[model samples]
Target: MNWNQIEGNWKQFKGSAKAQWGDLTDNELTEAEGNRDKLVGKIQERYGIAQEEAERQVDSFAAGLKH
Candidate 1:
């Protein structure tokens, strides 16, 4: 989903976000403030992944929800 859809459903979507980025704490996700870039950065920082990989993971997660 796009950022608007993600932000609109932040509470519901956060669980999936946590599942995808298991290393990220709830506080980090909250601190991301509905910004995709910040969320990806947090995931990268917490999981030690490269920026491109983190973005890909987030994109993949979003794509999975389309099914």
Candidate 2:
């Protein structure tokens, strides 16, 4: 799925996001509010990963989603 679709259905995707990054709290995800950049930033912060890695992970996550 594309970012637009993901953003539009963020409520459903929250479960998948939580599964992918258990380190992230629900409030953090809610703060991200389906913003790709925000999610990437949160992931980077929580995982202590490079920005590029965060972007890669987010892209991969989006790619793996359906409908």
Candidate 3:
């Protein structure tokens, strides 16, 4: 799904995001507030992954929501 759709429907999809990234706390996700950049940064920080990998994962996660 697109960022607009994701942002608009953040509440519904955040559970799935939590499932995918269990290291992230509830407050972190809430802080992200459906912003892609915020999510990427959080994932990167929490997972100790490279920024590109975080973006790739976020892209995959967003794409999965479309199906």
Candidate 4:
């Protein structure tokens, strides 16, 4: 999904995000302010992954939801 969709559905999406990346805390998710880029950046920072890797992971996780 795009940023708008992710922002609109953050409540539902957050659970899956947390499940996918257990390192993130509820506070961080809340503080991300529904911004996909910011959320991904936080994930990248917290997990020490490269931007491309973080994006790939997020994309993969999002794609899995379609199934």
Candidate 5:
């Protein structure tokens, strides 16, 4: 799904995101507020990964969701 869809359905999809990144807190996810860039940045910060890797992971996660 596209970012718009993800944003709109964030409440449902947040669980999937948490599954993928267990270290992420609910508050951080709330702060991300379904924005792709914010999620990527939070993942990068929490996971200590490179921006590219974070983007790739987020892209993959987003792609796996059913619309």
Candidate 6:
């Protein structure tokens, strides 16, 4: 799904996001609120990954979602 669609249906996708990144906390997800950059930052911080790697993972996650 596209980022706009994901942003629009963030609540519905929250579970999937949680499943994808188990290290993420509820507050972190809530803080992201479907913003790709915010989510990437949270993931980077939690996973100790590079921003580029986090972005790649988040992009892959979004691509895997059903429209």
User: Which pairs clash inside model 5?
Assistant: none
Task: Score residue 47 of candidate 3 by CA lDDT.
Answer: 94
Off by over 4 Å in 6: none
Q: Which residue pairs in model 4 clash with each other?
A: none
For candidate 1, the 10 contiguous residues with the lowest summed lDDT are 58-67
- Quote the positional error of residue 35 for candidate 1 in Å: 1.3
Q: Could you tell me which 10 consecutive residues in candidate 5 have the lowest summed lDDT? A: 9-18
Q: Which ranges in model 3 have alpha carbons more than 4 Å from their true place?
A: none
Write the residue-wise lDDT of candidate 6 on 43-66 in tens digits. 999999999999999999999999
TM-score of 3: 0.96
Candidate 2 structure quality by residue, lDDT tens digits, 1-67: 8888888999999999999999999999999989899999999999999999999999999999877
- Candidate lDDT scores, in order, read 0.83, 0.94, 0.95, 0.81, 0.95, 0.95
> Which parts of model 1 are misplaced by more than 4 Å?
none
lDDT of 6 at 41: 95
RMSD (Å) of each candidate, 1 decimal: 1.7, 0.6, 1.0, 1.9, 0.6, 0.6
lDDT of 4 by residue, 1-67 (tens): 5767777878878888888889999998887766868888999999999999988887787667641
- Candidate 3 or 6, higher TM-score? 6
Model 1 whole-model lDDT (C-alpha atoms): 0.83
Clashes of each: 0, 0, 0, 0, 0, 0
True lDDT of residue 22, candidate 4: 90
Residues 1-67, candidate 1: write the lDDT tens digits.
Answer: 7777887777878888888877889999888866789998998898898999989988887777641
Clash-forming residue pairs, model 1: none
Q: Return model 3's CA RMSD, one decimal.
A: 1.0
lDDT of 5 by residue, 1-67 (tens): 9999999989999999999999999999988989999999999999999999999999999889997
Better of 2 and 6 by lDDT: 6
